[model samples]
Target: MSQSDHDCLFCAIVTGERRGHIVSADDAAVAFLDSRPLFKGHVLVVPVRHVETLTDLPHTRVGSFFGRVQDITSAVERGLQAAGTFVAMNNRVSQSVPHLHVHVVPRQRKDGLRGFFWPRTSYGSDAEADDYAARVRDAL
Candidate 1:
C-alpha cells in the first residue's frame, strides 16, 4: 500500500477496517451517510480506491464513481422529499477529509443556504454562469 493509503481514513472505511455507516457499496465505489450531515439524508459518495482529488481519480473509474454519486443524489432528494439537491466536491480547499468525496446535500427553496463563497454573490445572470460552463465544457 502507498503511504497515503496507510494514513487514509476513507481507505480504512472502504476496507472495513474502520466502521462507517455504509449505505451502499459495490466493486467501484461506496456510499455512506455523512458523520456530520448538511441534512439528515446527506450522503458522501467516494471511490472504492483512495483518490485524494477529482483530477487524481482514474479516468476509467470516473463513470462508476460518479454513477454511484448520481444514484445517491437522486435517492437523497427522493427519500428526503427535498425540492432539490446540491451536489458538490472540494478538491483540496474546504475538504474536511483527504479522500475524494462528493457531498449530496438536500435542498429546499429558500433554505438559507446562500453565500456559498467568499462574501459570495449569486451569478449576475444565467448567461454568465453559462459562459463559465461553456469554458469548462470546452476544456473537457
Candidate 2:
C-alpha cells in the first residue's frame, strides 16, 4: 500500500477498513456494485491493491486485474440476463473515485441509456441489492 491508499476510500474497502458490498474477489482483484448505478446490475471491478489510475497499476498485475474484470463483465451480462455489458474504466478525468475501477454495467437492446449520458438510480432494498451481487458472484 502507498500513502495514497491510506486516504483512499476503495483502499479502505479492499483492506476491510470500510464496508463495500463485494460481489466477487480473488487475491488480485475485487468486484462490487456501484452504489449509484447506471442500471440495476451495474458493477465496479477493482484491483485489491490501491492504484490511482490504470497506468498506475503494476505491469505484472495487469493480466490478473483485467482478467478479473473480463470475468466480471461476463457475469454482469449472464447474471442479469442482459444482452451485453458496458465495460469501461476512467483514467483520471471522470473517475469519480481515486482508485482504479472498471464499470461493468448491464445492458439490453434499446434500454434507453446513452453513451456517457449516465442516468443513475438506486437499488430498491438491501436484500434486492445483495441479490444482484449474489447473482454476479454465482455467475463467476
Candidate 3:
C-alpha cells in the first residue's frame, strides 16, 4: 500500500521502519501488542494504509479495517481467555498516534481495568516484564 511519511507512526510500522510487538498480520492490516497496555493482553490493530483518523479514510477502507479489527478482537478474546474485550478507535482528540488504529483490550472480571480509571504501573523488574510478555505472547 502507498503511504505518506509526515508524522505517521503506523506507516513506519507497516513499512518496517519502526518496531512494535506484532501479534498477527495479513495483507490488509497488522495486529500488535500495545507497548503501554490498558490490560495485560491489550492489542492494537492497524490498517496498512496511512489515515490520520477514522473519518479521514474512505468508507470501504474503514469497513475493511474494522472487519480486521473485529477478527483480532475475537482472537484476543479466545486466546487470552478473557471474559470480554473492549474495542475502541480514537479520533483527533484521543489520537495518541496519528494513524487510524483500533485498540482491542482483553478484559476480565475484577482485573482492575474497568472503565479505564486505573492508572498503569510499570513492571517492577525484568522477570515481571518477561512474565507479562510471555503471557501475552501465549495468548497471541
lDDT tens readout by residue for model 3, 71-96 = 88899999999989988887988789
Candidate 1 wrongly placed segments (more than 4 Å): 121-140
Pairs with steric clashes in candidate 1: none
Better of 2 and 3 by TM-score: 2
Q: Which stretches of candidate 3 lie over 4 Å from their true place?
A: 1-6, 116-140
TM-score of each: 0.81, 0.79, 0.75
Could you tell me which 10 consecutive residues in candidate 3 have the lowest summed lDDT? 1-10
Model 1, position 76, has a per-residue lDDT of 82
Best by TM-score: 1
**lDDT of each residue in 1-140, candidate 1, tens digit only:** 47768978888888898988998999888888889987777888989888899999988999988999888988888888999898989999998889999988999999878736457567899999999999999999
Ranking by lDDT: 2, 1, 3
Q: Model 2 has how many clashing residue pairs?
A: 0
Per-model RMSD to reference: 3.7, 15.0, 14.5
- How many clashes in each structure? 0, 0, 0
Residue pairs with clashing backbones, model 3? none
